[model samples]
Target: MKGVVISMIVVLAMIQFMVKPGQAISCGQVDASLAPCVPYLTGGGNPAPACCDGVKNIKGMAATTADRRAACNCVKDAANRYSNLKDDAAQALPAKCGVQMNIPISKSTNCDVIN
Candidate 1:
């Protein structure tokens, strides 16, 4: 009985460590997923299939509020890195790709307000 109880406690502790809270996405992942979209965003043209795929991937990865906010911040940071990034193109990206994003991909967007 003592051994069984101890094993159960160990399992519970392991489960706690396995389930991390509020860190579903990282900036590196966001950057990788959205990198392909940069060219289209900078220069007006039909977004490539890879760009659209990246957009969709970003939407899918942002499952939780934290993830969404992180993605938003990362996108804003990435956009800032490119001075030529077009606002019109960024605004049109989600609709153009047929992907709905909770957080708009813009440098000016307030990530903290994304819920």
Candidate 2:
């Protein structure tokens, strides 16, 4: 019985290494996808086809809650990187792209508020 328990413990430890738990998707994916939307998000122009495509891509990538939160944080950071971002314009990208985001994408948005 003791040998069996030891073997089980070893197997569990190996499994832990193989499958890292709580590994949220990289925020870089979100950043890359949304890069094209910067001009529109900053109120410089209407969202282009590429910008809308990025929004769709990001929306599809952020499937899990953790991924969504990470995406929200990344997008918020990206938004802050801009100089003259209009809040309404930033908020309207999702609608323009026909992709609804679980987490709001804005410089002033609180990532913690997203699920």
Q: Per-residue lDDT of 38-76 in model 1, one digit per residue for the tens?
A: 779999797888788878877877888888988899889
**Winning candidate number (TM-score):** 1
Query: Which pairs clash in the backbone of model 2?
Result: none
Off by over 4 Å in 1: 1-23
Report the lDDT tens digits of candidate 2 across residue range 26-88. 555666566667678766568999788878877776778778888888888878888788888
Q: What lDDT does each candidate get?
A: 0.79, 0.73
Which lDDT value does model 2 have at 64?
84
